[model samples]
Target: MGLALQGEKIARNRFTGEKIENGSFMLCDFSGADLTGTEFIGCQFYDRDSRQGGNFSRAILKDASFKSCDLSMADFRHANALGIEIRECRAQGADFRGTSFMNMITSRTWFCSAYITKSNLSYANFAKVVLEKCELWENRWHGAQVLGASFSGSDLSGGEFSGFDWRAADVTQCDLSNAELGELDLRTTDLQGVKMDSHQAAQLLERLGIAIIG
Candidate 1:
Protein backbone atom coordinates (compact mmCIF):
# COMPACT_ATOMS: atom_id res chain seq x y z
CA MET A 1 0.00 0.00 0.00
CA GLY A 2 3.05 2.26 -0.23
CA LEU A 3 3.96 4.70 -2.97
CA ALA A 4 5.78 3.22 -5.96
CA LEU A 5 7.00 4.72 -9.26
CA GLN A 6 8.14 2.58 -12.18
CA GLY A 7 9.35 2.93 -15.80
CA GLU A 8 11.95 5.35 -17.12
CA LYS A 9 9.56 7.83 -18.77
CA ILE A 10 6.70 6.82 -16.41
CA ALA A 11 4.46 6.23 -19.43
CA ARG A 12 1.94 3.34 -19.35
CA ASN A 13 2.50 2.85 -15.62
CA ARG A 14 -0.21 1.27 -13.54
CA PHE A 15 -0.67 1.80 -9.80
CA THR A 16 -3.86 0.39 -8.36
CA GLY A 17 -4.78 0.55 -4.68
CA GLU A 18 -1.55 2.28 -3.84
CA LYS A 19 -1.56 4.52 -0.76
CA ILE A 20 0.43 7.71 -1.29
CA GLU A 21 -0.16 9.40 2.05
CA ASN A 22 1.35 12.77 2.80
CA GLY A 23 3.60 12.62 -0.25
CA SER A 24 5.07 15.75 -1.79
CA PHE A 25 5.60 15.32 -5.53
CA MET A 26 6.95 18.56 -6.96
CA LEU A 27 7.60 18.83 -10.71
CA CYS A 28 6.86 15.16 -11.33
CA ASP A 29 5.90 14.10 -14.83
CA PHE A 30 3.00 11.61 -14.78
CA SER A 31 1.96 11.96 -18.38
CA GLY A 32 0.01 9.10 -19.99
CA ALA A 33 -0.05 6.89 -16.90
CA ASP A 34 -2.84 4.50 -15.94
CA LEU A 35 -3.26 5.23 -12.24
CA THR A 36 -6.61 3.67 -11.54
CA GLY A 37 -7.97 3.59 -7.99
CA THR A 38 -4.86 5.26 -6.57
CA GLU A 39 -5.27 6.82 -3.13
CA PHE A 40 -3.42 10.11 -2.94
CA ILE A 41 -3.98 11.20 0.63
CA GLY A 42 -2.60 14.58 1.65
CA CYS A 43 -0.25 14.99 -1.34
CA GLN A 44 1.25 18.35 -2.31
CA PHE A 45 2.14 19.32 -5.86
CA TYR A 46 3.46 22.75 -6.81
CA ASP A 47 4.31 23.66 -10.37
CA ARG A 48 6.02 27.05 -10.21
CA ASP A 49 6.66 27.30 -13.94
CA SER A 50 4.12 26.33 -16.58
CA ARG A 51 6.69 24.10 -18.24
CA GLN A 52 6.93 21.96 -15.06
CA GLY A 53 3.29 20.89 -15.18
CA GLY A 54 2.04 17.51 -13.98
CA ASN A 55 0.34 15.74 -16.83
CA PHE A 56 -2.44 13.17 -16.39
CA SER A 57 -3.52 13.12 -20.01
CA ARG A 58 -5.37 10.06 -21.32
CA ALA A 59 -5.04 8.32 -17.96
CA ILE A 60 -7.66 6.03 -16.50
CA LEU A 61 -8.15 7.59 -13.05
CA LYS A 62 -11.45 6.08 -12.08
CA ASP A 63 -12.46 6.12 -8.42
CA ALA A 64 -9.17 7.77 -7.50
CA SER A 65 -9.24 9.88 -4.33
CA PHE A 66 -7.15 13.03 -3.92
CA LYS A 67 -7.60 14.36 -0.40
CA SER A 68 -5.95 17.61 0.68
CA CYS A 69 -3.55 17.81 -2.25
CA ASP A 70 -1.93 21.01 -3.43
CA LEU A 71 -2.22 20.37 -7.16
CA SER A 72 -1.54 23.83 -8.55
CA MET A 73 -1.01 24.14 -12.34
CA ALA A 74 -1.54 20.42 -12.98
CA ASP A 75 -2.84 19.31 -16.37
CA PHE A 76 -5.57 16.68 -16.49
CA ARG A 77 -6.66 17.14 -20.09
CA HIS A 78 -8.59 14.26 -21.71
CA ALA A 79 -8.33 12.13 -18.57
CA ASN A 80 -11.01 9.57 -17.74
CA ALA A 81 -11.78 10.67 -14.18
CA LEU A 82 -15.03 8.89 -13.54
CA GLY A 83 -16.21 8.86 -9.92
CA ILE A 84 -13.10 10.63 -8.73
CA GLU A 85 -13.28 12.17 -5.25
CA ILE A 86 -11.12 15.26 -4.88
CA ARG A 87 -11.78 16.68 -1.42
CA GLU A 88 -10.03 19.68 0.14
CA CYS A 89 -7.53 19.97 -2.70
CA ARG A 90 -5.83 23.23 -3.67
CA ALA A 91 -6.05 23.02 -7.46
CA GLN A 92 -5.22 26.55 -8.57
CA GLY A 93 -4.50 27.16 -12.27
CA ALA A 94 -5.14 23.50 -13.15
CA ASP A 95 -6.23 22.55 -16.67
CA PHE A 96 -9.15 20.13 -16.79
CA ARG A 97 -10.15 20.62 -20.41
CA GLY A 98 -11.96 17.62 -21.94
CA THR A 99 -11.75 15.63 -18.72
CA SER A 100 -14.58 13.22 -17.97
CA PHE A 101 -15.77 13.66 -14.41
CA MET A 102 -18.90 11.57 -14.31
CA ASN A 103 -20.35 11.30 -10.81
CA MET A 104 -17.30 12.89 -9.23
CA ILE A 105 -17.31 14.46 -5.77
CA THR A 106 -15.16 17.59 -5.43
CA SER A 107 -15.74 19.24 -2.09
CA ARG A 108 -13.94 22.24 -0.58
CA THR A 109 -11.46 22.41 -3.47
CA TRP A 110 -9.96 25.74 -4.50
CA PHE A 111 -9.86 26.04 -8.29
CA CYS A 112 -8.59 29.60 -8.68
CA SER A 113 -7.84 30.53 -12.31
CA ALA A 114 -8.37 26.99 -13.55
CA TYR A 115 -9.49 26.27 -17.11
CA ILE A 116 -12.20 23.60 -17.28
CA THR A 117 -13.51 23.99 -20.81
CA LYS A 118 -15.36 21.17 -22.63
CA SER A 119 -15.34 18.89 -19.58
CA ASN A 120 -18.08 16.37 -18.82
CA LEU A 121 -19.06 17.11 -15.24
CA SER A 122 -22.38 15.34 -15.06
CA TYR A 123 -23.65 14.42 -11.61
CA ALA A 124 -20.63 16.01 -9.93
CA ASN A 125 -20.72 17.49 -6.44
CA PHE A 126 -18.88 20.77 -5.89
CA ALA A 127 -19.70 21.78 -2.34
CA LYS A 128 -17.98 24.81 -0.83
CA VAL A 129 -15.45 25.10 -3.65
CA VAL A 130 -13.91 28.47 -4.49
CA LEU A 131 -13.56 28.94 -8.24
CA GLU A 132 -12.34 32.51 -8.49
CA LYS A 133 -11.34 33.83 -11.94
CA CYS A 134 -11.75 30.36 -13.51
CA GLU A 135 -12.68 29.69 -17.13
CA LEU A 136 -15.42 27.06 -17.22
CA TRP A 137 -16.97 27.63 -20.61
CA GLU A 138 -18.64 24.85 -22.62
CA ASN A 139 -18.67 22.48 -19.66
CA ARG A 140 -21.56 20.11 -18.99
CA TRP A 141 -22.75 20.34 -15.39
CA HIS A 142 -25.95 18.39 -15.44
CA GLY A 143 -27.23 17.30 -12.03
CA ALA A 144 -24.25 18.87 -10.28
CA GLN A 145 -24.43 20.01 -6.65
CA VAL A 146 -22.84 23.44 -6.12
CA LEU A 147 -23.91 24.37 -2.62
CA GLY A 148 -22.08 27.21 -0.88
CA ALA A 149 -19.57 27.40 -3.74
CA SER A 150 -18.33 30.74 -5.06
CA PHE A 151 -17.36 31.43 -8.69
CA SER A 152 -16.29 35.04 -8.58
CA GLY A 153 -15.07 36.61 -11.84
CA SER A 154 -15.33 33.33 -13.73
CA ASP A 155 -16.30 33.03 -17.39
CA LEU A 156 -19.13 30.49 -17.56
CA SER A 157 -20.97 31.83 -20.57
CA GLY A 158 -21.24 28.59 -22.55
CA GLY A 159 -21.70 26.26 -19.55
CA GLU A 160 -24.90 24.31 -18.96
CA PHE A 161 -26.22 25.08 -15.49
CA SER A 162 -29.93 24.63 -16.01
CA GLY A 163 -30.94 22.57 -12.97
CA PHE A 164 -27.90 23.12 -10.78
CA ASP A 165 -28.49 24.40 -7.26
CA TRP A 166 -26.37 27.54 -6.87
CA ARG A 167 -27.76 28.65 -3.55
CA ALA A 168 -25.45 30.57 -1.21
CA ALA A 169 -22.87 30.81 -3.99
CA ASP A 170 -21.14 34.12 -4.71
CA VAL A 171 -21.19 34.59 -8.48
CA THR A 172 -20.36 38.28 -8.45
CA GLN A 173 -18.72 39.71 -11.59
CA CYS A 174 -19.06 36.40 -13.46
CA ASP A 175 -20.10 36.28 -17.14
CA LEU A 176 -23.08 33.97 -17.44
CA SER A 177 -24.53 35.24 -20.71
CA ASN A 178 -26.52 32.61 -22.65
CA ALA A 179 -26.12 30.06 -19.86
CA GLU A 180 -29.18 27.95 -19.07
CA LEU A 181 -30.66 29.61 -15.98
CA GLY A 182 -33.94 27.75 -15.96
CA GLU A 183 -35.06 26.79 -12.46
CA LEU A 184 -31.76 27.88 -10.95
CA ASP A 185 -31.99 28.93 -7.29
CA LEU A 186 -30.62 32.41 -6.73
CA ARG A 187 -32.22 32.96 -3.36
CA THR A 188 -29.03 33.12 -1.33
CA THR A 189 -26.67 33.75 -4.25
CA ASP A 190 -25.10 37.14 -4.97
CA LEU A 191 -25.90 38.32 -8.48
CA GLN A 192 -24.29 41.70 -8.11
CA GLY A 193 -22.24 42.86 -11.14
CA VAL A 194 -22.95 39.59 -12.99
CA LYS A 195 -23.40 39.82 -16.75
CA MET A 196 -26.64 38.29 -18.00
CA ASP A 197 -28.44 38.27 -21.31
CA SER A 198 -31.44 40.52 -22.00
CA HIS A 199 -33.91 37.66 -21.70
CA GLN A 200 -32.18 36.30 -18.68
CA ALA A 201 -32.28 39.66 -16.91
CA ALA A 202 -36.00 40.00 -17.59
CA GLN A 203 -36.71 36.54 -16.23
CA LEU A 204 -34.62 37.12 -13.14
CA LEU A 205 -36.33 40.44 -12.46
CA GLU A 206 -39.73 38.83 -12.82
CA ARG A 207 -38.75 36.21 -10.29
CA LEU A 208 -37.73 38.98 -7.87
CA GLY A 209 -41.12 40.77 -8.22
CA ILE A 210 -39.53 43.66 -10.09
CA ALA A 211 -41.57 45.30 -12.83
CA ILE A 212 -39.61 46.03 -16.01
CA ILE A 213 -40.58 49.26 -17.86
CA GLY A 214 -40.13 49.05 -21.63
Candidate 2:
Protein backbone atom coordinates (compact mmCIF):
# COMPACT_ATOMS: atom_id res chain seq x y z
CA MET A 1 0.00 0.00 0.00
CA GLY A 2 2.46 2.60 -1.18
CA LEU A 3 2.26 5.39 -3.74
CA ALA A 4 5.20 7.38 -5.06
CA LEU A 5 4.49 10.80 -6.56
CA GLN A 6 7.15 13.20 -7.73
CA GLY A 7 6.11 16.85 -8.27
CA GLU A 8 2.41 16.11 -8.58
CA LYS A 9 -0.82 17.39 -7.03
CA ILE A 10 -3.27 15.17 -5.14
CA ALA A 11 -6.10 17.53 -4.30
CA ARG A 12 -9.65 16.69 -3.31
CA ASN A 13 -8.97 12.96 -3.39
CA ARG A 14 -11.09 10.94 -1.01
CA PHE A 15 -8.70 8.31 0.36
CA THR A 16 -10.80 6.99 3.14
CA GLY A 17 -9.47 3.83 4.80
CA GLU A 18 -6.35 3.84 2.66
CA LYS A 19 -3.15 2.42 4.06
CA ILE A 20 0.02 4.05 2.67
CA GLU A 21 3.20 2.80 4.20
CA ASN A 22 6.92 3.27 3.43
CA GLY A 23 6.38 5.65 0.55
CA SER A 24 8.07 8.87 -0.58
CA PHE A 25 5.88 11.69 -1.88
CA MET A 26 8.05 14.64 -2.81
CA LEU A 27 6.47 18.00 -3.75
CA CYS A 28 2.96 16.57 -3.75
CA ASP A 29 -0.08 18.63 -2.84
CA PHE A 30 -2.92 17.02 -0.88
CA SER A 31 -5.15 20.01 -0.34
CA GLY A 32 -8.83 19.31 0.36
CA ALA A 33 -8.25 15.56 0.51
CA ASP A 34 -10.67 13.49 2.56
CA LEU A 35 -8.14 11.13 4.09
CA THR A 36 -10.34 9.97 6.91
CA GLY A 37 -9.09 6.83 8.66
CA THR A 38 -6.00 6.73 6.44
CA GLU A 39 -2.87 5.13 7.77
CA PHE A 40 0.55 6.40 6.68
CA ILE A 41 3.44 4.58 8.27
CA GLY A 42 7.08 5.43 7.47
CA CYS A 43 5.98 7.92 4.81
CA GLN A 44 7.85 11.04 3.78
CA PHE A 45 5.82 14.07 2.74
CA TYR A 46 8.25 16.70 1.61
CA ASP A 47 7.67 20.40 0.92
CA ARG A 48 4.92 21.92 -1.30
CA ASP A 49 2.31 19.49 0.06
CA SER A 50 -0.60 21.04 1.94
CA ARG A 51 -2.59 18.16 3.42
CA GLN A 52 -5.43 20.16 4.87
CA GLY A 53 -7.94 18.07 6.83
CA GLY A 54 -6.31 14.65 6.65
CA ASN A 55 -6.15 11.72 9.06
CA PHE A 56 -2.95 9.79 9.87
CA SER A 57 -2.22 6.83 12.13
CA ARG A 58 1.13 5.79 13.54
CA ALA A 59 2.63 7.89 10.73
CA ILE A 60 6.37 8.26 10.66
CA LEU A 61 6.47 11.83 9.36
CA LYS A 62 10.09 12.56 9.99
CA ASP A 63 11.32 15.95 8.66
CA ALA A 64 7.84 16.69 7.32
CA SER A 65 5.93 19.95 7.13
CA PHE A 66 2.34 18.84 7.04
CA LYS A 67 1.94 22.55 7.77
CA SER A 68 -1.20 24.64 7.38
CA CYS A 69 -3.17 21.39 7.10
CA ASP A 70 -6.31 20.44 8.96
CA LEU A 71 -5.04 17.29 10.63
CA SER A 72 -7.73 17.04 13.26
CA MET A 73 -7.97 13.59 14.85
CA ALA A 74 -4.72 12.46 13.20
CA ASP A 75 -3.11 9.73 15.27
CA PHE A 76 0.70 10.04 15.22
CA ARG A 77 1.82 7.63 17.90
CA HIS A 78 5.54 7.01 18.21
CA ALA A 79 6.21 9.25 15.21
CA ASN A 80 9.43 11.13 14.71
CA ALA A 81 8.49 14.68 13.68
CA LEU A 82 11.72 16.53 14.20
CA GLY A 83 11.79 20.09 12.77
CA ILE A 84 8.23 19.96 11.54
CA GLU A 85 5.85 22.91 11.25
CA ILE A 86 2.37 21.52 11.89
CA ARG A 87 1.01 25.02 12.33
CA GLU A 88 -2.59 26.28 12.08
CA CYS A 89 -4.14 22.84 11.79
CA ARG A 90 -7.30 21.44 13.33
CA ALA A 91 -5.45 18.77 15.29
CA GLN A 92 -8.09 17.94 17.83
CA GLY A 93 -7.70 14.45 19.34
CA ALA A 94 -4.27 13.91 17.74
CA ASP A 95 -1.94 11.49 19.47
CA PHE A 96 1.72 12.60 19.50
CA ARG A 97 3.42 10.31 21.95
CA GLY A 98 7.21 9.97 21.72
CA THR A 99 7.28 12.63 18.98
CA SER A 100 9.84 15.36 18.62
CA PHE A 101 8.47 18.82 17.93
CA MET A 102 11.65 20.82 18.21
CA ASN A 103 11.41 24.33 16.73
CA MET A 104 7.94 23.73 15.38
CA ILE A 105 5.39 26.49 14.81
CA THR A 106 2.10 24.97 16.00
CA SER A 107 0.33 28.29 16.41
CA ARG A 108 -3.45 28.59 16.53
CA THR A 109 -3.83 24.81 16.41
CA TRP A 110 -6.62 22.90 18.16
CA PHE A 111 -5.42 19.94 20.20
CA CYS A 112 -8.41 19.26 22.37
CA SER A 113 -8.30 15.82 24.01
CA ALA A 114 -4.94 15.06 22.38
CA TYR A 115 -2.48 12.72 24.07
CA ILE A 116 1.02 14.27 23.87
CA THR A 117 3.05 12.46 26.46
CA LYS A 118 6.87 12.62 26.47
CA SER A 119 7.04 14.92 23.47
CA ASN A 120 9.70 17.53 22.93
CA LEU A 121 8.00 20.87 22.26
CA SER A 122 10.90 23.17 22.93
CA TYR A 123 10.91 26.57 21.20
CA ALA A 124 7.47 25.95 19.74
CA ASN A 125 4.89 28.68 19.26
CA PHE A 126 1.48 27.51 20.48
CA ALA A 127 -0.15 30.91 20.60
CA LYS A 128 -3.95 31.09 20.78
CA VAL A 129 -4.23 27.29 20.58
CA VAL A 130 -7.00 25.31 22.24
CA LEU A 131 -5.71 22.28 24.19
CA GLU A 132 -8.60 21.57 26.49
CA LYS A 133 -8.57 18.24 28.37
CA CYS A 134 -5.31 17.15 26.75
CA GLU A 135 -2.76 14.86 28.39
CA LEU A 136 0.71 16.46 28.36
CA TRP A 137 2.66 14.49 30.90
CA GLU A 138 6.47 14.85 30.91
CA ASN A 139 6.47 16.99 27.79
CA ARG A 140 9.15 19.59 27.30
CA TRP A 141 7.86 23.07 26.59
CA HIS A 142 10.92 25.09 27.48
CA GLY A 143 11.11 28.53 25.82
CA ALA A 144 7.72 28.02 24.18
CA GLN A 145 5.04 30.65 23.62
CA VAL A 146 1.65 29.45 24.87
CA LEU A 147 -0.07 32.78 25.16
CA GLY A 148 -3.88 32.84 25.09
CA ALA A 149 -4.11 29.03 24.95
CA SER A 150 -6.83 27.13 26.78
CA PHE A 151 -5.84 24.15 28.93
CA SER A 152 -8.95 23.74 31.03
CA GLY A 153 -9.23 20.33 32.72
CA SER A 154 -5.92 19.17 31.19
CA ASP A 155 -3.39 16.96 32.92
CA LEU A 156 -0.01 18.74 32.96
CA SER A 157 1.81 16.77 35.61
CA GLY A 158 5.58 16.35 35.11
CA GLY A 159 5.47 18.82 32.21
CA GLU A 160 8.53 20.99 31.65
CA PHE A 161 7.45 24.56 31.01
CA SER A 162 10.52 26.51 31.96
CA GLY A 163 10.54 30.01 30.38
CA PHE A 164 7.12 29.45 28.83
CA ASP A 165 4.44 32.14 28.69
CA TRP A 166 1.00 31.40 30.11
CA ARG A 167 -0.43 34.87 29.66
CA ALA A 168 -4.19 35.05 29.12
CA ALA A 169 -4.33 31.24 29.02
CA ASP A 170 -7.21 29.43 30.71
CA VAL A 171 -5.75 26.70 32.95
CA THR A 172 -8.63 26.36 35.33
CA GLN A 173 -9.17 22.95 36.97
CA CYS A 174 -5.86 21.61 35.62
CA ASP A 175 -3.07 19.87 37.48
CA LEU A 176 0.25 21.76 37.73
CA SER A 177 2.26 19.70 40.17
CA ASN A 178 6.02 19.51 39.52
CA ALA A 179 5.52 21.64 36.41
CA GLU A 180 8.10 24.29 35.68
CA LEU A 181 6.36 27.63 35.15
CA GLY A 182 9.28 30.00 35.58
CA GLU A 183 8.74 33.61 34.41
CA LEU A 184 5.28 32.82 33.09
CA ASP A 185 2.72 35.63 33.19
CA LEU A 186 -0.38 34.13 34.76
CA ARG A 187 -1.93 37.49 35.59
CA THR A 188 -4.88 37.30 33.22
CA THR A 189 -5.05 33.50 33.20
CA ASP A 190 -7.72 31.65 35.14
CA LEU A 191 -6.52 29.38 37.94
CA GLN A 192 -9.78 28.58 39.68
CA GLY A 193 -10.25 24.97 40.83
CA VAL A 194 -6.69 24.14 39.79
CA LYS A 195 -4.49 22.02 42.03
CA MET A 196 -1.17 23.59 43.08
CA ASP A 197 1.34 23.35 45.89
CA SER A 198 1.74 25.94 48.66
CA HIS A 199 4.73 27.55 47.00
CA GLN A 200 2.92 27.69 43.70
CA ALA A 201 -0.20 29.14 45.33
CA ALA A 202 1.84 31.78 47.12
CA GLN A 203 3.56 32.73 43.92
CA LEU A 204 0.27 33.01 42.10
CA LEU A 205 -1.26 35.09 44.88
CA GLU A 206 1.70 37.43 44.83
CA ARG A 207 0.89 38.18 41.24
CA LEU A 208 -2.79 38.71 42.16
CA GLY A 209 -2.40 41.70 44.48
CA ILE A 210 -1.16 39.73 47.48
CA ALA A 211 1.97 40.66 49.42
CA ILE A 212 3.88 37.99 51.30
CA ILE A 213 5.65 39.13 54.46
CA GLY A 214 8.83 37.50 55.64
Candidate 3:
Protein backbone atom coordinates (compact mmCIF):
# COMPACT_ATOMS: atom_id res chain seq x y z
CA MET A 1 0.00 0.00 0.00
CA GLY A 2 1.23 3.44 -0.96
CA LEU A 3 0.00 6.96 -1.30
CA ALA A 4 -3.32 7.00 -3.15
CA LEU A 5 -5.12 10.03 -4.49
CA GLN A 6 -7.90 10.47 -7.03
CA GLY A 7 -8.94 13.41 -9.20
CA GLU A 8 -6.28 15.67 -7.74
CA LYS A 9 -5.10 18.87 -9.31
CA ILE A 10 -1.30 19.01 -9.25
CA ALA A 11 -0.78 21.26 -12.21
CA ARG A 12 2.28 23.49 -12.52
CA ASN A 13 3.82 21.94 -9.44
CA ARG A 14 7.48 21.01 -9.14
CA PHE A 15 8.07 17.48 -7.95
CA THR A 16 11.61 17.12 -9.17
CA GLY A 17 13.80 14.25 -8.00
CA GLU A 18 11.04 12.65 -5.94
CA LYS A 19 10.30 8.93 -5.85
CA ILE A 20 6.82 7.48 -5.39
CA GLU A 21 6.33 3.71 -5.29
CA ASN A 22 3.15 1.67 -5.40
CA GLY A 23 1.07 4.80 -5.42
CA SER A 24 -2.11 5.83 -7.21
CA PHE A 25 -2.89 9.17 -8.78
CA MET A 26 -5.88 8.18 -10.82
CA LEU A 27 -7.48 10.82 -13.02
CA CYS A 28 -5.09 13.45 -11.69
CA ASP A 29 -4.29 16.63 -13.55
CA PHE A 30 -0.57 17.28 -13.92
CA SER A 31 -0.53 19.65 -16.86
CA GLY A 32 2.31 22.15 -17.03
CA ALA A 33 3.99 20.56 -14.03
CA ASP A 34 7.74 20.12 -13.69
CA LEU A 35 8.45 16.46 -13.01
CA THR A 36 12.13 16.52 -13.83
CA GLY A 37 14.04 13.54 -12.43
CA THR A 38 10.95 12.30 -10.59
CA GLU A 39 10.46 8.54 -10.48
CA PHE A 40 7.19 6.65 -10.14
CA ILE A 41 7.38 2.90 -9.63
CA GLY A 42 4.49 0.46 -9.44
CA CYS A 43 2.01 3.30 -9.54
CA GLN A 44 -1.46 3.57 -11.03
CA PHE A 45 -2.43 6.59 -13.07
CA TYR A 46 -5.53 5.21 -14.71
CA ASP A 47 -8.96 4.85 -13.22
CA ARG A 48 -10.29 1.51 -14.33
CA ASP A 49 -13.89 2.21 -13.39
CA SER A 50 -14.04 5.55 -15.12
CA ARG A 51 -11.74 4.44 -17.93
CA GLN A 52 -9.72 7.58 -17.55
CA GLY A 53 -6.02 8.13 -16.96
CA GLY A 54 -3.88 10.90 -15.51
CA ASN A 55 -3.27 13.92 -17.69
CA PHE A 56 0.30 15.05 -18.19
CA SER A 57 -0.27 17.12 -21.25
CA ARG A 58 2.06 20.10 -21.67
CA ALA A 59 4.07 18.95 -18.68
CA ILE A 60 7.79 19.48 -18.40
CA LEU A 61 9.02 15.93 -17.92
CA LYS A 62 12.72 16.24 -18.63
CA ASP A 63 14.61 13.26 -17.27
CA ALA A 64 11.49 12.08 -15.41
CA SER A 65 11.07 8.31 -15.25
CA PHE A 66 8.29 5.80 -14.68
CA LYS A 67 8.85 2.09 -14.01
CA SER A 68 6.15 -0.57 -13.69
CA CYS A 69 3.46 2.07 -13.70
CA ASP A 70 -0.04 1.67 -15.10
CA LEU A 71 -0.26 4.53 -17.57
CA SER A 72 -2.90 3.09 -19.84
CA MET A 73 -4.75 5.74 -21.85
CA ALA A 74 -2.73 8.52 -20.23
CA ASP A 75 -2.64 11.84 -22.06
CA PHE A 76 0.88 13.00 -22.78
CA ARG A 77 0.16 15.24 -25.71
CA HIS A 78 2.52 18.17 -26.30
CA ALA A 79 4.71 17.22 -23.36
CA ASN A 80 8.39 18.18 -23.27
CA ALA A 81 9.84 14.78 -22.53
CA LEU A 82 13.54 15.18 -23.30
CA GLY A 83 15.66 12.45 -21.73
CA ILE A 84 12.54 10.94 -20.12
CA GLU A 85 12.66 7.29 -19.15
CA ILE A 86 9.67 4.92 -19.13
CA ARG A 87 10.82 1.37 -18.47
CA GLU A 88 8.49 -1.64 -18.12
CA CYS A 89 5.37 0.49 -17.87
CA ARG A 90 1.92 -0.56 -19.06
CA ALA A 91 1.24 2.31 -21.44
CA GLN A 92 -1.23 0.63 -23.78
CA GLY A 93 -3.36 3.13 -25.70
CA ALA A 94 -1.42 6.05 -24.23
CA ASP A 95 -1.61 9.22 -26.29
CA PHE A 96 1.78 10.66 -27.17
CA ARG A 97 0.77 12.43 -30.34
CA GLY A 98 2.46 15.77 -29.71
CA THR A 99 5.21 14.80 -27.29
CA SER A 100 8.55 16.45 -27.97
CA PHE A 101 11.72 14.57 -27.21
CA MET A 102 13.97 16.86 -29.19
CA ASN A 103 16.16 19.85 -28.58
CA MET A 104 15.87 22.31 -31.43
CA ILE A 105 19.22 23.35 -32.83
CA THR A 106 17.96 25.54 -35.67
CA SER A 107 15.04 25.96 -37.99
CA ARG A 108 15.90 22.90 -40.04
CA THR A 109 18.10 21.01 -37.58
CA TRP A 110 17.31 19.30 -34.30
CA PHE A 111 18.23 16.29 -32.16
CA CYS A 112 15.90 14.08 -30.10
CA SER A 113 16.33 12.16 -26.87
CA ALA A 114 14.31 9.71 -24.71
CA TYR A 115 14.74 6.33 -23.04
CA ILE A 116 11.59 4.17 -23.24
CA THR A 117 12.91 0.64 -22.88
CA LYS A 118 11.13 -2.64 -22.16
CA SER A 119 7.63 -1.17 -22.03
CA ASN A 120 4.27 -2.35 -23.35
CA LEU A 121 3.06 0.26 -25.79
CA SER A 122 0.39 -1.70 -27.62
CA TYR A 123 -2.27 0.30 -29.47
CA ALA A 124 -0.52 3.55 -28.61
CA ASN A 125 -0.98 6.56 -30.88
CA PHE A 126 2.26 8.24 -31.94
CA ALA A 127 1.11 9.74 -35.19
CA LYS A 128 3.24 12.52 -36.68
CA VAL A 129 5.69 12.37 -33.78
CA VAL A 130 9.48 12.57 -34.08
CA LEU A 131 11.65 10.23 -32.02
CA GLU A 132 14.94 10.46 -33.84
CA LYS A 133 18.24 9.34 -32.29
CA CYS A 134 16.74 7.96 -29.10
CA GLU A 135 16.87 4.75 -27.07
CA LEU A 136 13.66 2.73 -27.48
CA TRP A 137 14.67 -0.90 -27.15
CA GLU A 138 12.74 -4.08 -26.23
CA ASN A 139 9.28 -2.54 -26.25
CA ARG A 140 5.98 -3.83 -27.61
CA TRP A 141 4.63 -1.79 -30.51
CA HIS A 142 1.60 -3.82 -31.56
CA GLY A 143 -1.19 -1.91 -33.31
CA ALA A 144 0.62 1.41 -32.92
CA GLN A 145 -0.32 4.21 -35.30
CA VAL A 146 2.77 6.08 -36.55
CA LEU A 147 1.57 7.72 -39.71
CA GLY A 148 3.99 10.42 -40.86
CA ALA A 149 6.19 9.79 -37.82
CA SER A 150 9.97 9.53 -37.87
CA PHE A 151 12.05 7.20 -35.72
CA SER A 152 15.33 7.67 -37.48
CA GLY A 153 18.66 6.84 -35.84
CA SER A 154 16.99 5.25 -32.82
CA ASP A 155 18.02 2.07 -31.03
CA LEU A 156 14.99 -0.23 -31.45
CA SER A 157 16.56 -3.61 -30.79
CA GLY A 158 14.51 -6.48 -29.30
CA GLY A 159 11.11 -4.81 -29.88
CA GLU A 160 7.85 -6.66 -30.52
CA PHE A 161 6.30 -5.16 -33.62
CA SER A 162 3.48 -7.51 -34.51
CA GLY A 163 0.80 -5.07 -35.66
CA PHE A 164 2.94 -2.00 -36.38
CA ASP A 165 3.02 -0.48 -39.86
CA TRP A 166 6.60 -0.03 -41.04
CA ARG A 167 5.73 2.07 -44.07
CA ALA A 168 3.64 4.47 -42.07
CA ALA A 169 6.72 5.99 -40.45
CA ASP A 170 10.37 6.77 -41.14
CA VAL A 171 12.71 4.32 -39.43
CA THR A 172 15.88 5.06 -41.28
CA GLN A 173 19.29 4.46 -39.68
CA CYS A 174 17.70 2.62 -36.74
CA ASP A 175 19.35 -0.29 -34.90
CA LEU A 176 16.93 -3.21 -35.28
CA SER A 177 19.00 -6.08 -33.96
CA ASN A 178 17.01 -8.94 -32.39
CA ALA A 179 13.63 -7.30 -33.03
CA GLU A 180 10.38 -9.17 -33.77
CA LEU A 181 9.75 -7.34 -36.99
CA GLY A 182 6.34 -8.58 -38.05
CA GLU A 183 5.46 -8.07 -41.70
CA LEU A 184 8.19 -5.49 -42.18
CA ASP A 185 8.09 -5.23 -45.97
CA LEU A 186 11.58 -4.60 -47.22
CA ARG A 187 10.58 -3.33 -50.62
CA THR A 188 8.06 -0.84 -49.38
CA THR A 189 9.62 0.27 -46.12
CA ASP A 190 12.81 2.29 -46.41
CA LEU A 191 15.74 0.70 -44.58
CA GLN A 192 18.48 3.14 -45.39
CA GLY A 193 21.39 2.89 -42.92
CA VAL A 194 19.41 0.46 -40.73
CA LYS A 195 21.38 -2.08 -38.70
CA MET A 196 20.37 -5.69 -38.09
CA ASP A 197 22.02 -8.92 -37.02
CA SER A 198 22.79 -11.79 -39.40
CA HIS A 199 19.84 -13.81 -38.16
CA GLN A 200 17.48 -10.96 -38.82
CA ALA A 201 19.09 -10.46 -42.22
CA ALA A 202 18.47 -14.12 -43.03
CA GLN A 203 14.85 -13.75 -41.99
CA LEU A 204 14.43 -10.76 -44.24
CA LEU A 205 15.98 -12.63 -47.15
CA GLU A 206 13.71 -15.60 -46.51
CA ARG A 207 10.72 -13.29 -46.85
CA LEU A 208 11.91 -12.56 -50.39
CA GLY A 209 12.05 -16.29 -51.22
CA ILE A 210 15.83 -16.42 -50.84
CA ALA A 211 17.23 -19.16 -48.59
CA ILE A 212 20.65 -19.10 -46.93
CA ILE A 213 22.38 -22.43 -46.19
CA GLY A 214 25.62 -23.29 -44.44
Q: How many residue pairs clash in each candidate at the backbone level?
A: 0, 1, 0
TM-score of model 1 (CA atoms): 0.48
Q: 2 or 3, which is superior by TM-score?
A: 3
| Top TM-score hit | 3
Distance from true location, Cα of 190 in model 1, Å: 1.2
Candidate 2 lDDT, 24-141, residue by residue in tens:
6665545334454455555655332443223333343433444334344344544444334343333443444444333334864433434555555665545555566666666677
The candidate maximizing lDDT is 3
Evaluate model 3: give its TM-score.
0.96
Ranking by TM-score: 3, 2, 1
Better of 1 and 3 by lDDT: 3
lDDT by residue (7-92, candidate 3, tens digit) is: 88885654667899999998899988999889999999989999988899999999999999999999999999999999999999
What C-alpha lDDT, on a 0 to 100 scale, does residue 43 get in candidate 3? 95
Instruction: Please give each candidate's TM-score.
Output: 0.48, 0.52, 0.96
Candidate 3 local accuracy as lDDT? Answer: 0.93
How far off is residue 33 in model 2, in Å?
1.6
Ranked by lDDT, top first: 3, 1, 2
How far residue 93's Cα lies from its native spot in candidate 1, in Å, is 21
Model 2, which residues run further than 4 Å from truth? 1-6, 46-112, 185-189, 196-214
* Pairs in steric clash, model 1: none
